[model samples]
Target: MPLPDPSLLFRPLRKLYRRLPLPYALRVLLGRIYRRIGSPVNRAIQQRILANSLFRPPHCHLQESLDSLPDYLFWGVIDWDFRHQRPQHLAEQLSLGGRRVFYISSTLQDDPRAGFALRPLDQTGRLFEVRLFARTAPIIYHIAPDATLACQLRRSIGELLSWANTHQVVSLIQHPFWTPVAGVLPNSRVVYDCMDLHQGFGNNAVELQDLERNLIGAADLTLFASAWLEQHWHQQIPRTPAQQWAVLRNAADFDYFSKPAQHPCQAPDQGPVIGYYGALAHWFDVELLAAIAEAFPHCTILLIGADTARIGARLRHHTNVRLTGEVPYRQLSAYLHAFDVCILPFRIESLTMATNPVKVYEYLSAGKPVVTVDLPELHEFQQQVTIAKDQQAFIDAIARALQAPASSAESRQRQAFAAQQTWQHRVQALLALTEGTQQQPRVSVIVVTYNNLAFTRDCLASLTADPQGQPLEIIVVDNGSSDGSVEFLQQWATSYGQTLILNDSNRGFAAANNQGLALARGEFLALLNNDTQVTAGWARTLRRHLQRNPGLGLIGAVTNNIGNEAKIDIHYQNSQEMAVRARQYTWRHAGLIVPCATLGFFAVMMPRSTYERVGPLDEAFGLGFFEDDDYCRRVEQAGLSCAFAEDVFIHHHLSASFAQMPGKQRQLLFERNKALYEAKWGRPWTPHVAREKP
Candidate 1:
């Protein structure tokens, strides 16, 4: 079989996007501002009206901390809202995994004058957000020499930097565009999730070479969706660090296909149905499918998918072949479930050799036995898939699968194996590719301060007062205070040989804390508020608890000012009073720790591994509010618990920073924060009185 023409497959997509109407120098400026302001509220109350829409983005939800976003900015090989592909599958699963996913649809389906449009994919909001840029191509497959067109596209794309920065997007996973516009996205990593050879693009081969080079050099990891492609890419590019490249095979959306077929349709009762769903492209073996149809004249061959190219008269003329045409990806499960056997007859050509058919895995999820041409890529799925060497074998395999009981152990094994290859599993592997592999420190204590020099001084004094000799590393981040807090802390940290990070202004609690966290080197990180004075041995006690319960993600001490469950019978009159009561409380409840779902970050400690898994605090809450609650919830999602160190006591000067603000501002902040928290977690924040056993 000859190699498929790239122009036939992808050029039209570029044409579609280029026809749609559509930012760049704006990118450089926005990137600069975003680094300072974090994320501005997406207050676009009006939706961009359009003539036609393949998919729409949802209205921006009320601010749910920047931390809640999906770790990736997914740019599908085509529009995500278009045909369901690898990116869409991964994005859907990742979204269900609790990360906000935004699919970049570009402006392919809209008019050149169309404005931006946003609409929720579903009421549950787990379907992922899709946005289309007016005047942009469905997929930018080729690089152009026209800088003006590029600028307009990037300037429009630059608008998303706020989303990128606000979400602290860790990676840009998709096609590479050359410009500072992409550089402005505040993403720590980039992934050229290579599914096909860049050389596959018909035109602009030279430009494609440059683009791939840029992507390869810029990408922290280049994960191939197929093993053959992984090896092919390696042979093309000069060998780099092997760790930077890996194979993350395409998998099915198990949850989607596992759902019993809805609105089931009965096929010809006498004949078994053999189904196939995918674009009828060059890689598809028309001759092979024709032969199968000839050998099994009684079997109904159901071809369910878009006919991207011309279909051969041979298969089209088959009396038993039923071309149901294209349907939405969500509806494909119904067709698959209606089948007794599935087939993936691909031409044994260069185009098919390296391809990994996503639909085959999806078919397996439905327990429809798959018979396919024996290709290198199919070997990976050999355990679950039947290798069809010839027309006779293909016919025999389909007959066997059709004859097998629906609930037979063979069918169950196929389903079980596909379940393990869900988009969730692949997403876990994707995340591993997007993170750095640095050796973390054993323990790092982080403290953020806005003002209140006395509270800050007292807090530091008490923490240092206890000489535990445990190699305790302290990091103090000062969020520009009008008082002499920065200067004093700078000098103090220097004298004590601790780390000090200074910010120009009060960037808010989450931002400041995240900054300190970025600098931390320990395996364990304790977030201590500047207004809290720790008791002697408080750190030692919490660290010991973490050591004892290796599985616990969060361990925080009780304080008189906050944490209803952690509060003891003491309020601070002064720093002197705090010191006295701390010693007394420590003796009263020694070695007592209570397991709880929620804990205060005021003096909470967690392992660096937990931080890596759950990520930094959400900066969207602004100035210091419910981000800690968000953090705890994220920790819980990671299968870890937050426990209170009941035996330990710390003194908290509640609302010390809020004291400087006017009453109205403080109240407004509280109301705003409360609303956001409710929207994100639906927590009522009903203050509970500490319940102590007699």
Candidate 2:
């Protein structure tokens, strides 16, 4: 009669927590915030600091000027957001300018490079109570502007401009969305950073296109992170010698990513380790991950990061895979050590092709041989890593990496390659570009919802609740949903009235997106899915990535249950099989992909202009499936690339609404679509692309 072990009693609870809902995610966040800011332990530390007079607040001070002039930077989404490529990387690099710099941002305490945190204001609002601190250079913060209180911002701006008037504010650098306001800045010079194609977003993309044009016209200089951005803009603008649009290719943190594990490691007991580390989002090739795990039952697939619950439902069966929820940055080394081979199984699209994955650098740093789908972003690392052309090729590459001798030389080569691409270097380039400009940054997000009311509500809620105070608008397109979705959206629109379109009957994915795209007025447009739940800083993550790489055609958020990361077979012969597979795969590959023919209807973001050229998603595909593929094909054909974000992920419950549909109908659609796809691409649809090529 010994007491039951606590571990056994709590195991099921822990699993339940792993599958917590969106509200739970927020509750957890609030709890953490409370603990950090209110808990006795934190209070004690603060008390100690106050007693010792060490509790200094964040500062944004102006210092002595140097020979070189400081620039006016309208930085967007810098410090608070935790993505691979954020504004901090740019700030750190810009600090290298060796000149006095002035920053016009909100809060300003979020970025570490700000080198200061803000303190509470005293009565009479004299700004700081002599708490103004300084960095190596100056990064002034006059809280970011928004629609709520223009008078207060104007006063703050007047003071900030008075200071800028005295000092030589070299240039104004701003994100595309802020173009409309960047023109209002007192400073004469302006620079536009076209990061992503933003208009395709479902709801908030109305102002992006107009904003981008204004920003481009107002800018003395223009720069882009992705090749597609530069090309797209360059084509639009008549050949002007003064136009300085450069493709600031996305770089990796080689130092952190290129090193090898210091200790010998072993995989889990069941099989060889094939793993993916980073955010598991909608753009991930979840299908590939699940298929690979299934194809090789002898392998243990490890996903090291936060649990992606809704998406994980697709991969519950595989006993060979396990999701080790988010680990501390310091502890990541140990997990990478356990992986024999790293994987970059991702959905190919306009968003993914233009991306520069940070994990690529981390994988190389770990000195673990890598296997990934052929993404344009990874084209540079093809020599050092294996680029899989299709599902079979992806599997083959994993096999090759696993079979390779775990030699130190191979490891060293990876580390050496990684050493060259540090976050510091990327930062330096940003500093160089924004040396002299004064432009405010604004962003517009376009989200498209067809009929998924619950999912769309979640997505819209996240945007409205974003911590960043930057000017943002949401353009939502409701494509004739009969599920009372229109009513729900109309209610939301009452509060967030900008642009909301309700179509009569479903107009297909492309046409609905086109409808949204037509109304985009921001400098950038972010296309999102109605069936997905986004994570913290999802918009900022996508924004920063696109900002850093203008050459990108599209960018996407990570999804919890994307492609295929589990081994649970979904080729169900009957409803029973489907249910069993669902249960099994859902448990097995909680954060990995469950095999899919293509990336699902979760999330994708791009600029407004890309749509102008690529047109809209092919309407012929109709409701769903193959539409994204056809769009991706158009992107590739257009020479613009797609990229996947490693930071943000949306929780997507795969084919949930379709679950109740008649099996015959689904089969018919599948066959019809397969035939249509084969007619278009000259190949029958299959789980793997081997049959088509070989």
Candidate 3:
């Protein structure tokens, strides 16, 4: 019998919608429908609004944006109105330099235009305070109750994006509703601030589930609020130069909450106020709270916030306890002013599993003694807060906190502790997420150019000045660049011949990379974008990590306008239109490893062995998207991993090549190539690319 043609096999499966069960088929159809309708419309609107903006000043240079972002920025957005306050402890991380912040939603009051208003549970006072107080860099504490709602609001307010034109750094503290808007920032580099396990919102569970996936696939970088979220997002967004996912966690606000205070007189002189505040729902370990409250009758307990109905009323009857019934944010300090201890009685549900409790930061901010159930995300903060192993241990911890006296030294110690957990510190940690050393490794840097004379010159200058300087070999892959590239390469070749490869046509990313790879003598080869300018020591940092982690086959770095280094481009298009337009500019902060199948011809590195084993990036990938991802998958399948070197960075101007192509032509090539990629991989490019970082 003759073997079946592989292409024919997929031809039949393409009818899965007609043959499969209704629900599964509907899901597939709906997804493609949404992407088609939503993506282009949003992109067009953002482009039109930002077209002539001042942010893209003619004199702006790639190096200038990299240097202007202040290296770090602290950030957070609110999910509920009460949790909407600025996390001061996290903010302290930005003290190293002039820090800057942008809130898609916030409670700061000093500035209105800078802060977006949130639909409050109580729309009572000032709606939401919008503050623009930072002298050099500002902090935006954007809060959104429902991310679904936020997306719609963002579209309504989409034109206001021009306001962000002048800002150096833009971080989107994404709630589910923000995904659509979060994905399309015409003028700003967006960070899909993934701070929690979004799918755990039981009522908003379905929407949350979809939103979580969208944010992971869309945002440029994701800042997980908790370790659980971080690990989860690592699987979703991936960590690579093209994407970034970092764990910033809910951090404490020092000094403001660390001041020593006397206990409140409202509570009958009791043992201690074992308080747990914020939203109360399924995530609240009802049995645990009851067990602790009932097990220890002498301790005075306080429960704050609405939605305490989920916890049984029997626990409410205790004479030693009081439900303060949703206190105002203004009165929170007063309530904490009287508290002896604070507790986080969380249930080990999916939410808790990946949550970085905002109250944890609040409790620490208040300098109140804290005791709570142990969680992986809190392990870093364990030293500062009192952690309980179980019910019995929780009771014991509460007793210890109550007995402890408020002291100046203790307050100073708490403040000191809070100081270490600032957003700047988190940003630094984020920037250095990829563990690569300063020592340079053998590197072959390849730049592919078609036109754009000015961009190619700057990119070359940057490559020549690379700080790592690891026995450098620079090869300019001239893919039929009509302008001065050929002449320029020849002139530079008299001095740099050992490094240049002048190709005749635009043989696409894969073919050109293959051509460059054929001549690469270095252990590691870099496929750089011609429109991009490298920062100091960028190559050395990527080389060090790939060298130390033997299992690593590919490494990517943070770059401007290539989406955040944490999340995939949900709006990813293969056509030239998808590339970063020459006029567009944005900022990126971190780096991470990409596990999904990707087209990484732009800025990536691979060992020569990888090229030999996985074979060159599929030439069928033509000009863009999926080639690098497919190659990386083959590498991972071969027992190697891809890495994102956060510290190493480059500035990429979007869509330099594809930008010149007509829309339909670009779309046709993308679809045809996408079908080919799926045929070889046995799966469409998913949010999670199977990978294990060495």
| Highest TM-score against the true fold, candidate | 1
Tens digit of per-residue lDDT, candidate 1, span 1-694: 2323424444575476456553556556655775564332211111122222232222455234233243456664566566888877787666666656666663343334322345556455444454535443434565532455444444444444333323234445566543223322321344677776546545433665676665665455678878888777667677544337788888888888977876765665457888888887656778778877787889888887767656645576788887777888778888888888888887786667777889888988987788998889889889889998887888788878778888888788889989998787888887665544522135688889988999999888877774322356889988888798888997998899999988898899899889989989887789898888776556656765675577899998878877467766775577666655554444334345688767777889987789899998999899977787778888998988888976577778787887888999888998898789888886676544575745
Residue-wise C-alpha lDDT for candidate 2, range 1-694, written one tens digit per residue = 2323434544685577667775977879866875685565544543343334422223355444432444344445222234325443444345454543344443322111112333222222222211112211122222223442222233333334333222223334444433433333321345565555444323224555565675675465676666765666677767455356666655555555445557634665656788887776666677897888888789888887765544465667777777776666655666777788899887887666656676777778778898888876677887788898999988887877777898768777887887776667665665566552323345566667667677777767756653322346778887777888899988888878767898897665667777777777766666666655554345544554555456666766444455532112235553334333332322221112112233333576666666666876777876666777677667767777775654344555666445545888877876777688779977655552211112
Q: List ranges where model 3 is wrong by over 4 Å.
A: 1-67, 70-81, 85-100, 106-158, 166-173, 184-192, 214-222, 230-245, 261-271, 287-299, 308-316, 328-331, 361-368, 377-393, 400-419, 431-694
- Higher-ranked by lDDT: 1 or 2: 1
TM-score of each: 0.55, 0.46, 0.49
Model 1, global lDDT: 0.69
lDDT of predicted model 2: 0.57
RMSD of each: 20.4, 28.4, 17.4
TM-score of 1: 0.55
| Full ranking by TM-score | 1, 3, 2
**Better by TM-score, candidate 3 or 2:** 3
Write candidate 3's Cα lDDT for 1-694 as tens digits.
Answer: 2323334434564576457667877778766874797555554444444333322212111111232342222233452344534343333233223333333343232211222333211222111122221111222222222543333333323322222232223435455544444443322344566666655664343544565676566455666777677766666544545456666665544444555445443666456567777887767877777777786688777787876555636566666667767776656666776777888888776778787776776677666677888887777777678778888898888777667777646645655677776555565665454222322246888777788888888878777753224357877788888887788877876775556777777888778877877777887888888887765446655664465467778877645466434323223243232222111212221222344234344678777677667776678788876676678778888887776654344566767888878999999987887788889988875643323224
**Alpha-carbon shift of residue 500 in model 3 (angstroms):** 3.8
Steric overlap count per candidate: 25, 111, 55
TM-score of model 3 vs. true structure: 0.49
